[model samples]
Target: MKKKLWLTILVLLMGGVNLCHGQSLNTTAAEVADFDVQSATSNMQDLKSNLDEVVSQLYSLDEKERGTDNAISDKYRATRKEIVNVIQTINQTTDTIGEQLKKITTYKKLMLLTYKDIQASRSGMVDTKQYIEDFSNFIYKLDNKLYNENTNTIDDLKLMINSDNIPLTLANDSLVQSMILQLNDLMNNFQQNEETQLETIKKLNDLKTRTKDTIEQYQTEIEKLQQKKNYLLQFMKLYQNDTRQRQLTINNFFESTKGVYDRTVELVKDIKKWVYKVDFDMERKITALNELENDNEAYPLAWPLYPIEQIQTYFGDINFQTEYGVPHVGIQIKAGQWTPVYAARDGIVYFVADNDEIGINRAMIVHTDGYVTIYQYLKKTVIKPGDTVRRGQIIWYSWWEPGTRGAGFISKGANLTFEIFKDGIAMDPFEILDASIVKDKEALPDGYQIKYLRDKYARPIDITNLELMTGTTLAKRENQFLIKYGVGVYKQVAFREDAVKDTNIDKDMVICIAFAESTLGRYLSTNANIGNVGNNDRWDRVPFTSAYGWARAIPVTLNNAYLWAYHTINQLSRYGNKDGNIYASSPINWQTNVLKCLSQIKGYYIPEDFPFRTGPNPNINNPTPETITFGETLTQ
Candidate 1:
């Protein structure tokens, strides 16, 4: 019995020793695995940061070129090339990391090893410090290399700029002109390069396959270890004569193992957070670069629509006969019913409405470049006055209308009226539109050849309604909103109210003018029934204009408002105080100046006796002092 007892004790000791050894091996593996993952994550992050810094530096150099001498511009170009090389290297590294992540099975093995090391540590096992040191050194080397490369690139840039025969393209132009162009070009290129770098960073951050798989594997292993530990505790308790001793050992093991698992989780969380930060930062930088690029004078047009079809009429010198025997100044095109009308350029919808009152449905867009386009006789508009429309975006649709006079004209069906203006003066649109888009059609009933207009068709009023009614007031207040919504009825009021306290203009005068023009929103009728009265076709008349919740008016009316305001300001400045103040005693001055402004503005809209009407018309009612005072309060 004594011999058996001794043998049993020996066997138990041996078993414990074997378990400890195995656990130690596993622990070592786990630590190595953890180090590998962390190393890769850190390397990728550093690479991304370095690339971002390079982009930022390049942008700065480009900005400097704008005001600097030709020598400085040349220096910037050379530095840009070196930075490009560094970017290429970073991209290569990112690709390597991505490839490694794809082999998830290997990563899983590494994770398992890390878990084992943690388990072994609980048994008082210790790993060599050399492993950790080696990893730290590896990361340090990469960082150092990146730093040196960046420094060299920057120094080279400075040298190039200071050297003779500056290689800058700006050196070829007049000194000042060359510098300006170089600066602009640099800014554009910098933005483009930054965007590309951001795309690459996004790709690297997206590498999740291996990481996810490893996480899952660690979870499975942890569960299994927990079950084993529980079983061992239960078995030891049952066999030990001294329960306290057995309990203490089991508790210690539990604490140590849990600590290891917890630490692993924390590391993973940190890596994820780093990736998110890097990604967000890159995005922000890209946005800034884009804004900088847009500030250049030769900035490309925001809207660059290619004509889908040919123009049927050219703007200017139109010979169409009106009911009163007056000739028109705009051109007209024949198109298929429901054909999409696109903005000729990125601009605000100036007017959009059914021409029923005038026997046509049309849409118009006003550009920041002082150009305006009109698309007449539309079935529907898809954009609003204040909406910032993109290039080539469909603004409205066209529909067929019956011809009033000639035989061939009647067969033409749907026709589009197109017009262009520069600072309120009508100009031929053919010069701006690409000629290849125009198609030749049969001669008109009036024995005239169809003129092909080159400008893009503007959206009529229906689309403007959609834009104004779709969003909250706050969203509509953004700069993009101003670009989309041109100066129209409601918008005009908003603009005036906002500008009332502006030192540039008189608040009372602006309010009075708006009241006279639109009756402070009371006279403006969006309901198609009351506003559009001429054509019976719902799609062809103002009555058919979209009743969107914001401002229900044709796009053309807003355009006219702009024309009116421009003329009003121009004429008023000629007579009254050019300081923008209007006094009660200045009524006569206001009237005279207003008449002159109207005469100028009306030239584009009407050609016959435009300044003098045949019938007697009453003067616009002036606002009382009380009403004007209240208007001032609203602006305040």
Candidate 2:
């Protein structure tokens, strides 16, 4: 029977060798590895239990005859030594052989599962090759441990289990029990590690599948753009330069190019993430992949607007009807006009639109880890599409109307509608915000409340609250302003500080004009002229070395050419050189809008600080610029 067992084991080892050469682990071998050593442990457990029973029985018999004998028996001494030797052997085998085997088995199982996931992805052979190498090494080590190290240990255990050594002393039995308990603990730890690794592998497989789908979608989009461009090229040839359709065709071509470029950029970001995964160690790789998977469905890490006074509407609020006339998809926070809003997380601006019906200014940002945030009803947006924003960076302001009561009379003040999306599905803000809105009252500053009053039109309007105000000197205020809303060249702290100290013009006037003209550098010309300093025709922008250069030149340039501009805020209407020689298309309210922004900065209405007076409306055709203001118009 022993000969037969040896022969069978030899055949299995040979088969395993063949399989290893072919770069695959043998399932029969793995099963054998799992079950083969368990019998040895079980035999050890039985022997230890039997020895314990024999020791108890012998102690009872010895207690009854203790006075009669009174001397140690030679048989008892020999048996004690033999049992001591066996217990020591058992400890050694459990510590070295049992521990090694468990580690190898656990690691092999992890590699196998990961190998299967990689294979199912239909990846190339190169991806599976490393796992195959690992399997081969583990199998070799396991074989050596089983055949070489476990051979003498198993023989010793068998010899120690004879009837002669059954009557072990209490001390010997104690040692045996301790070793068995230790082996069981090691086994439990091994099982837990295996379970954790398996869970991580499952998450990694899901992430790989999602990544593949996203890449395919990008490819499809690029193909569509290519087809559109081809058709436009044919259309352009017929129209030539003389036709009005010529310019339209060129614009279509540019749009197609931009679409392809954007898709490529997004695809590259995906590739980089995959490369990042490959750079980590095996254990770290598993942990990182698990985290990446979780992040894909995680909530936003920051609030869209800080220190909000009230939330008027919550996500999925069925009782309340939003301007869209549908179940609310996001929460609405009531804020004072031009209150600064920040990006919820690090992300690239996906979409930016001005004058939307539901919200005046709207933005949708897509984060790297599968989160998307939407901000609507903004009075102004400082960031542009494709711009990367950091978490907590200012991107826009709350919606408000010009020429209205303290609170926006027409638009109901600044109502910011915020939404968070995970994996393209809307998530309840309360879940993502971790119920902070309800339980975390400390998140809001003291006295943070919106005060309301009735306008001349008998409508409730929000007036500016003190919490939004800042009290500081002019130079120091510019630094805070740049930090809160600055972008492009305007973001340079040292340059802004120097300009504020050196420029003869009012620092607030330059900042307000820059915001009104280019949204604080969002609409700068290639020359970085943030305020569109010189080139008139309204649409053209003159270049400057830096925002500071344009700022310093503001007073000089206006004083030299359009000297009437310094006379009053309305005189600056000639700066843009639009129709009827106005500064902007909405010429009548431009000065008032700038003055209101300045007042918001000062925390009080201070229009006279600019030393300017209102004049006749400079615009030609438009009688009303604020008539169709956003947030007031609710289009679903």
Expressed as tens digits, the lDDT of each residue in 507-576 for candidate 1 is 3333333333333345544442222222222323233343232222211121121111221232222232
By lDDT, the best candidate is 2
Candidate 2 lDDT over 431-547, as tens digits, reads 555232221244433422111111112211122332323646444555566667777556444444355453234456667777776667777765667544555544555567655
Best by the TM-score measure? 2
- Model 1 — which ten-residue stretch has the worst lDDT? 607-616
lDDT of each: 0.36, 0.45
Model 2, stretches more than 4 Å misplaced? 1-300, 322-324, 356-359, 401-411, 434-636
> lDDT (0-100) at residue 149 of candidate 1?
38
Instruction: Give the count of colliding residue pairs in each prediction.
Output: 38, 2
TM-scores for all candidates: the values are 0.22, 0.25
Q: Clashing residue pairs in candidate 2, if any?
A: 407-462, 573-583
